[model samples]
Target: MELEVYTYQFLRRRSRISSSRRRKSRSISPRRLKSRSPTPKRHKRRKSRDSMSLVSESSSASGGPKENKDDSEILKIEEENKKRRQQEAELKLIEEETAKRVEAAMRKKVDESLNAENIKLEIQKRLEEGRKKLLVEVDAQLEREKEAALIES
Candidate 1:
């Protein structure tokens, strides 16, 4: 009876899977698909510097190229900006040099502390600490052994 019920369920599932409800597994391949983007690239127009010239009628007005008021203002602003940048660079250099000097002094202090005499003193201190810890541990172990001996007796 159980076999018949299971076979009926299996047959129904197989029929459902084989019917229009079947899902086709797509197989992936190592190939690129055609993009065919909607918007095409636009053609850009380029101008050459060789064909450019000053529009002013007189070229000797300022002994140089004729620049408009806005251009002159921009040039002045650029000069001011350049000067400011130079000052900032100089300040940064001074700060860096000061930092380097401070760092060198700090490194020298560290080197001095790590000298042979200081290193020997540091090692002696660590050895003393280790000896103290060892003595405490040994005392604790001796106390434990003494307690065990008394209990055994």
Candidate 2:
């Protein structure tokens, strides 16, 4: 009666038995909602009622085509499962993207700090070299002045 879409998620394994039978059976089979497990007599009474319903269905089947009630339930369960899987997949993708963004931010912060430390070390090295050159020049100037004073005397 209706068309369905195909997806890779449906390609994976699925349960042979549909859980919707128990999950939504209240709508499909109301009589099953009430249980009389503690009382055997009530259980037997329910079984008899079930048998009577089956007998009527069998007679109707003989008179005409049997209704595909079970088939509709199976379709509904399949759709429910697919929708749940799609939502879960979307959530997983979102989580992975967030984690990647955090990792990239952390890497950028570490690289920035490392570059700052390297620049500080380079400035200190240049300043030390300049101080050494000035000390050497001052020592040469003092020796020249002393020689001049001795020659004049």
Candidate 3:
């Protein structure tokens, strides 16, 4: 009987501990849910307001002739840099175009040379054929003359 009472007491204490843990977990989850809902909006508003004030304050403080002069000088430097970059780009394009033109001229020269060589070869072939034809005609005339002499004799 005493052992049964002890077992009952242990089971009751375990149930109580589990119930308390469940309550703690439930309470913590709701707090986290509520805090996460509105934190981002509030934080963003605060940051934007802070940044705007800082910008206004700095602009007001630095609103002077010296600042304007510095700004103009910076602008001039930027414009000069931009012009230099544009000139460099133009020079690069001109160089590329020149290279292309030179390459095309060299190709044209090579083609013309090849065409001239072909023409020379064709002329030589035609000359050789004409020479052969003339030789054949001369031989035929000599044969005719010999035949005529024999007949006359």
Query: On residues 1-153, what C-alpha lDDT tens digit does candidate 3 reach at each position?
Result: 765565465446545886436333322433343323546876899889798677657766667557767877889999999999999999999999999999999999988886897877987999999999999999999999999999999
> How well does model 2 score by local distance difference test?
0.67
Models 1 onward score TM values of 0.44, 0.34, 0.38
Candidates ranked, most accurate by lDDT first: 3, 1, 2
Q: Write the per-residue lDDT of candidate 2 for residues 40-146, one digit (tens) a residue.
A: 87688888879867876865654422344554566798999999999999999999999999999999988887579787798789999999999999999999999
**Candidate 3 vs. true structure, TM-score:** 0.38
Instruction: Give Cα distance to truth, residue 86, candidate 3, Å.
Output: 0.5
CA error at residue 88 for candidate 1, angstroms: 1.1
- Whose lDDT is greatest here? 3
User: 1 or 3: which has the higher TM-score?
Assistant: 1
Model-by-model lDDT, in order? 0.68, 0.67, 0.76
Could you tell me which residue pairs clash in candidate 1? none
Off by over 4 Å in 1: 1-67, 116-119, 145-153
How many residue pairs collide in each prediction? 0, 0, 0
Ranking by TM-score: 1, 3, 2
